[model samples]
Target: MTCSEWADENFYLSAESAYIEGRWETAPFQVAILNSMGNDEIRVVNLIKSARVGYSQMLKAATGYQLQHKKRNGMILQPTDSAASSFMKAHVETAIRDVPVLKELAPWFGKKHRDNTLEAKKFSNQRQLWCLGGTAAKNYREKSLDFIIYDELAAFPEDVEKEGAPTFLGDKRLEGSAFPKSIRGSTPKIKGHCQIERAAQESETDFLMFVPCPHCGEYQSLKWGGKDAPFGIKWAENNPRDVWYLCEHNGCVIRQHELTPHFAKAQWRCHKTGITTVDGYEFLLNGQVSETPESVTWNIWTAYSPFTTWERIARDFLNTRDDQGKLKTFVNTTLGETWDDETGEKLEWENLYARRETYLPTIPEWAVYIAGSVDTQDDRLEIKIKAYGPGEESWLIGYKRLIGDPAGELIWQKLTEYVDQSFQHASGAKMSVGLICIDSGGHYTDEVYAWCRQDPMRRIPIKGASVYGKPVANFPRKRNRKGVYLTEVGTDNAKDIIYSRLAMQAKDLTKPIKGYMHLPMVEWADELYFKGLTAERKKLSFVKGRRVYRWECPSGVRNEPTDLEVYNLAAVRIAQQHFGLDLDRARPEGRKNQSTKKRKSVHQSSWL
Candidate 1:
């Protein structure tokens, strides 16, 4: 029997571990991913996934298939001892206790209860399923198994007590078996450092779930569309509330509800122009798959989750384009792509100054949300307010430096009033600053922290880390001595995204492009504005024989404009993540929270 078929017939989900508790039924999109684990030809299967995508349950089903159906000895290992214990309780224990087939074949009971331990489960069929702790090399030593399941491989330590990579140690255990197999899955972390990504790259085949377009019945992978992407997924410039997908083969508007049960009409495709073979396949680069290779590895990314929408993804992209860290999460978790930091762009004050538009204080017609950032000094506090629109196209609407002792309450109060005031969008809509990020790394840290503590949702305290790959926005819950959350800003990471976007200065002022920044010809952004914003240039230097990139300004030049831009970008990210700040639909005034509830519509994708 097929693994998915076995699961459907006998598997039952315990209420404790699963959100949907019932008879185990494989989702349509999950059929290929689950079956690949049971496929005898494919000896190595790896899944790079996002959360809420049934990977945990998929692993459980695969384990049951190995023990009950095939009667094979296997092992499942987590990253840490605690995590292994937790998985045993939440997943393994429940499956055995609830499912009748699993219960009858289970080996939890024996004299002195030696077989039913967390470390290992001995089945009645003379086959044993070992549960190993993630850290120690000793756990992998005694296990000579037919197959191994590496759960959350990214979380496992790179080296187990300096023995070697945990995966290598596990692979050494499989040499004894004739048809040795391994399965590893994770959501991935940073690029060049992700375990799951590296494993998947080694794989011979990379399969993307493709669904047929409702209109033309042509199979195509769903793409997040913009200028470069003309089809697949599309959204409005001002409202993601009205989002839909464009059929790649035909220009058919498939509403969000029309995509219900994406699995029922979906199939896995690995090549741009040909069929997929597990043991040997090609990767599509620049729209064409490369030569077919030979190996025993299969890679799968559950790109479309049952609950995920093109609108949510589109809005997230628009909301996070200005923030590198948040955009990295979007890329990793949503797009299932590794993020590479590329932040080298030359900036000239003359070019930036000349491109200024003839606008006063009024917000641009395209702007839908607003954010403010502050740079604190001993003598003054510098603030810049930027308005954002669809695809993160932004305008520098205001910049002001309040001259006063930052330690005094007078300046802080002024700052609060300034941020609290509303601005008029060209559409006559009003907008309150969605979020304000204040630099608390300076001498006035106490005052900044205290003020931010009063209203953390809007007034956020920030500290620049300049870490290479850290996200621009994170609530590490690192509280100050005064009991205030001090947010860590990845200034270097944010600069990478900022400069890349700034480099894409659109020549045509009317065209709205993602990451394009617009400046006004106002007194606030006068002669020094461009100079301050362009002060810092990317400088490459060798650190311990390794090339490292750092943003450097001339010794005496002021770069508060660019610094404030990072803070504001982080502010927008914080707002998006913590405060539901959707750039396409999120509004601070007169606009209510857009209902994410899937609207009722005819299921047009199905053909009788």
Candidate 2:
């Protein structure tokens, strides 16, 4: 069957009415694209759209066309099972029931349940629509498919290399077809993935629904401008009449113009231009859109909904305001902006204490030995002590927010004393300092690093710890020594382990260990998971032929406390591995104290 034949048979005239009613362009475009795809000349079609522009319906139309006209296996893969079910139930069923041609062509369409599989037949050809999740992509390589649809392509898991690429799946489906057409469509979610690949393959069309200028004969795309464009309702208020139009070119002296009787007769146009580029989407410092030299075409579809009222958006901003008058999720997601600093309210210290208290009693007696992390700064030191069992359970024993010059000998004295005192409190078997992960992140790290490199009375074990693994060396023999202990620690490598452990634990959603309860850590873990950086590994590179490793922190935040927190966690992990501590056991034998006053002195000077 030809593309036009299929369109004439099944495409609904109501689709045009929907478009005219300023509802969604999905119904019309879906029918049009399905008609185009039935042609042998069209190999692929890409759709780029603003939010809520109805790409889902278009996808369903393409799927329906394949089922009715083609006699081959079809597949639709979504990033998740839930999304696939929603798409099938919403659009596929709508097409089958509402479009009379499809109901007559494929009798089984609406009868299928929203499960893993759906089957239908038209004439003598058999068609199957399987909604598989991303995980099943690799296992289906043997199936010859006639059609493939990737839904919510951007939100596809980052491990596409493991899950398998949608393009590869689409190609595999087209293998035996005499005339195969693969249609891809998605809103811009992130910078890369299926949307990017499809956009790269096709010529972009600026799908502007135009309105005629009242005073001039020119018909152009309409946009909110100046005080008329003021956020939300201001644009509607300034232009009172919904007929205002402006020239697309910036810096044009043209002002607000009305639609006149003669000019209103022109038709809306969708111009085929070049592909959309990343730079075309860049916003200016003041939050206005910027114009760049790169000429990329966009199928720009503005919302048919009333111009978002500035008052409405402003009220949304005010409603989400924190104590500091900052809009929490509004400024980041709605405004399409980035933050220069971490502006959201930090988790309250009291809340952290409360969560910690609930989990404290479960600490096993055998996990008495503690590992400490010291994040050194010029003015103050951030210290964290954690207790771990032989297996998975770990606890945050104690953390100190200490003040005073971190570089001074007195801080080290205080740290050493704190360690000794903590051991004394846990006195039983042996309470020994297993590992100390110090942050050599700043310019003055050398001084503290040298101190850590020094032997601690043959009692407290001080190992040189990196993110990836631990490297051991003797304590500094002299105070002025600089060569041996100073080494670049890979922060990324350490964070990878910390984040992986946290992710695994989060998936279980069980209560955490008792001694290590910290509300702040839980909040940080949540943020990291939401940003999809939970198990992300560090990337290694070469600059000037020298090896370097880097880490990307979770999105929507900075990397200070998280870095320090991971450093501490890594130290405890290393300690557990080194000592063969049984993390799974309810109680393990505690470490025996080998420290005298000298050990105490060292502890006081290092971390207090």
Candidate 3:
């Protein structure tokens, strides 16, 4: 019989009238379920829809169709026994009392048990609809039904190892008959669970509803809630008007207009218009039509009622700006798209690149060179070799990253390699070998100091420099004196040199000094500036007089290779003091005899 005739005889008269007058859209879900069941080829069907979207009514319709046309036992599983009872009372009982056609088909409709089972045999077609709680472990054992409907599958409880109750029931239903068609439907709870599973198994006949776009004729699924669209009201203006016409494509110019036929044909196109596989189900299930709920749509079926206007949304987006006049976090979370960071501060990659570019090529050859720096975990040693030119330019030449933690024999080996390479690069450069800074800031500091004292490499004239700004005399006195001839210098003095060079470079930013001798120095200096170490200061006491403030270490936390830059600066200072490479003019008096001070402990400073 026609839907109108069947509805008139079996359902509420008002429902029949609504159907006849086209007041309701033909429940696409009902047609999908019916077609899948009648064909016998589709054994599973899963439905998902927004809340209050007439899913229950569609299920009732499906139940009526099954009762009128086929003799088959089916089970309807609800998340709880209470819900199952409510379904029976609201849907099953109402259908029996209100539908004359269903009464004729099932004479025992009102006379069946409401708790677990209902059976009717008086009609021409004998069938039963059993209700069960989804949590009941034994419910599947009691039913050899041709059909099963699992509702609210998202909340089904099961062992974490197993799929869930819906899949468990689906497996059992498959055992009943090859032609059995089961329906599972629920709202999504997570990315990889029941909704995802069922969506994975859908077929072409599986109905996915789409509202056409008023412009561009594209079919789009509407996204009405979540962090992006926090206005939970489903409609645009909250006036029971349709508001589903926003374009999903980035940079689309379509705006919300009154639902019209011309606009309907332009927006909202089905994602699976020609595809024919269960695999395509995932695309449709996860797809959202609008990035925000206030989007415009064609008037096919208003997913949201009482719509909000686009102008208000745009204005809200604009007004919610940060102190910088950029969108605030709320705007980013709601309308503007930006990656969220847990830390309040942003790490600027451009700054890192800029610093690296500025200091990589300007190191000079005629200078005193020394490699120094600290090491972090995984041999990531920040080593820098500094050389002084004829003037104020201190060339930070060689920066090396040694593998592994900063301590131990491996570091010494890498240091040796770096020194050899640096010396070769600066061959014949007349510069005194001064202090090689070694950071003695942690547990390994004593060991490093001891190694510097005991190793034969001490004879190579490499002085140990500390990273933290402790006095050079404060470090532990060395007992063994047979290895590398090491002298300790306060890192404060080293930082002084670095900051001085940085100040000079900053002053020359507008018209940067040219030549390869200036490039690496400028680049390293830029890195220091970016790190906020634009200057260094030190409070000192003269042997006979008053306190004095001298340029100390550059300000800021020392990162990788920054200590190396300090070592380069120190070497340049030493070369200027002794070798004259960093001096502005020839010393009137011949260079004073460069006396070697006792290898004092290099004070650790915080410059690096």
- Model 1 off-target regions past 4 Å? 107-112, 226-228, 260-265, 272-274, 277-303, 311-325, 342-608
TM-score of each: 0.54, 0.41, 0.41
Worst lDDT window (10 residues) for model 1? 599-608
Descending-lDDT candidate ranking: 1, 2, 3
User: Which parts of model 3 have CA positions greater than 4 angstroms off?
Assistant: 1-39, 109-124, 160-165, 193-210, 215-244, 248-273, 276-608
Candidate closer to the true structure by lDDT (higher is better), 2 or 3: 2
Q: What's the lDDT for candidate 2?
A: 0.45
lDDT of 3 at 254: 40
RMSD of each: 20.5, 17.7, 20.5
Model 3, 1-608: lDDT tens digits are 43323433444523331223222233332333333333344455665433433456556555665667555667777887788877776667666556666677655555653422432223446566777677766665656667777776666765322535455655576475655757666554432334423443443333333445554555544442322343221333433233233356432334355433332222223344422211111222244322211111111112322223544443443344322223323222232122122112223424333444343332223333333443333445555555443344345455555666555677767665665452332222223223454554444555566545643222212244434454322222343454333445555555544444443323333232322233343433455434533322343221111112333333455444434454444434443343333233322122123222210111111121
lDDT of each: 0.73, 0.45, 0.43
Instruction: List, residue by residue over 1-608, the lDDT tens digit for candidate 2.
Output: 54434544564423422343221232222333444444444555554444334445445555666777665467777777676666555556556666665676554554554332432223224456666665455535666667666665545654555755656555676779766656555444422233433454454333334444444445455442333232112224323333223445332223232232322243323344322122222312234443321212224333222324334443444455432224323423334222223211223323333333333323334343466667666677766666654443456655565778766788778877765553432222334456666666665565665566664322222233444343322233433354333323345455544544443323222433333323333432344322332323343322221223445444555344555556555555544444454445432133233344322322211221
- Candidate 2 stretches with Cα past 4 Å from truth are 1-39, 69-73, 107-124, 160-163, 192-246, 249-298, 304-608
Candidate 2 has its poorest 10 consecutive residues by lDDT at 274-283
Best by TM-score: 1
